[model samples]
Target: MRLTQHDATAPTGMRNNYVVMRPQNLSVGVLPVHDDGSVTLVGQQRFGLMNYSWEMPEGGAPYDEDPIDGVKRELAEEAGLAASHWREALKIELSNSITDQRAMAWVAWGLSAMPIAPDPTEIIRVTRVPFGDLMREIARGSVRDMFTVATTLRAYHMAHQGELPPCLAKAMLASVR
Candidate 1:
């Protein structure tokens, strides 16, 4: 395989300037969609926060495993539900304070309608929240799970052009706080 080299000193255009070593780990994610137009999310106590907030379950992609497969595994491991139908959505560079990683977004539907076996390290509750509540959460800036809110809203926009379920839109309009 052919690879390009670039400079490390320049702030950008590193593709033609340098080659950096990759980290030892990777991550992938998915937003499980519900038939009723809601989404299955999770809540966990976060840093700089008093309590938990809503977010779709997600986690790492295993070595050599397909991103899609990784997302399915994450769903089962994080939410305890097996994912079936899915589609590729977006791929983004997840840059955080400590590391740079690739996180993929997927659209998964047709849940198994059964219980999940979440990871022991995770203290999360799988919640079925209507879009209205999520929109309100966004409006109030109460959604600490920025990824969850952004990805799901984009997917919802993709599915319905920002016209989420009618009740949700009505609620969003009413909750102008």
Candidate 2:
């Protein structure tokens, strides 16, 4: 929640000064798949970068809130989609050395169109791409968001491991060649 700089003497009698950041946030990333096997992605215009970045639907949740709930809300708000099936795909410490921020990634399917209600401050573009195409873009460095990259790779692993439904996995991986 705050950053502070402090100076201290080490056991070797050496002086050290460093800045410490305290973070109190948890986030969720959702990779939504359509029944037809395409995956939903969102393009967000980041103010800091003054450029648009493509990534899975993601948002910050209060530390006390359920990650699944937060991601479900994000999917609807950012992609205008709702999913009936959900699976926890990964949990990661995002930039742990510098911040306490943690993220939960989810794979969701059985999707249907929904009303989008994005935050007024956000400008998002939603698109659907075939699973293999999405993977290719990621491999080419087009989709560079850490959360999206992690979640997509995890989903690909799940498909190969037969963790996903057979039909869906087949549809998703069909274009890999």
Candidate 3:
């Protein structure tokens, strides 16, 4: 992350110092759902926070790479899941006021087991939980990552609104009550 200060005029017609963060790459996040309506999450100890966090499989995509491909690689490396179906769930600018980091969120189903191959520096624990349980965890703040929160909520909305495949939406929304 690079931070730069620039001379700018505020909306109020006042001169001000504006600081901006320039991020090098865009990011992608995937919410992986199984046939039974379960979602897979990854637990990892974040070096910045020195605490464990549970979040959807997410990673940075180089400027030249497609975001979907980057997220598919993340899903395989972090969760050991291969998805046959995928949908764009959200597109967001993460902390836009401070940085130019953008992210794409995806919902993936039609899953199959695979071998995980995470980066050597990462130690990730993968878990599959019911969609409802995952929702509760998000509501209770156990899952605090912004990418996960936004993507999961968007998936829930899509499921409720019949934006997903009928069978998949049915399975996903069945546990709501």
User: What residue pairs are clashing in model 1?
Assistant: 6-16, 6-17, 6-18, 7-17, 7-18, 80-116, 80-117
**TM-score for each of the candidates:** 0.70, 0.91, 0.96
lDDT of 2 by residue, 61-103 (tens): 8788877888889999999999999989999988875666788
Prediction 1 global C-alpha lDDT: 0.65
| Winning candidate number (TM-score) | 3
Clashes per candidate (backbone, < 3 Å) = 7, 1, 0
How good is model 1 by TM-score?
Answer: 0.70
| lDDT score of residue 177 within candidate 1 | 31
Q: Which regions of candidate 2 are displaced past 4 Å? A: 4-16
Candidate 3 clashes between residue pairs 3 or more apart in a chain or in different chains: none
Model 3: runs farther than 4 Å from truth? Answer: none
lDDT for each residue of candidate 1 in 1-177, tens digit (9 for 90 to 100):
133354555455444345443454466777776666566777777655666767777777755877777788778877777656776666776655334566777767776765667776667877876666766777778775656766766665655554344544343334233
Better of 1 and 3 by TM-score: 3
Instruction: Return the candidate ranking by TM-score, descending.
Output: 3, 2, 1
lDDT of 2 at 127: 93
Score candidate 2 by TM-score against the native.
Answer: 0.91
Q: What is candidate 3's local distance difference test score?
A: 0.90
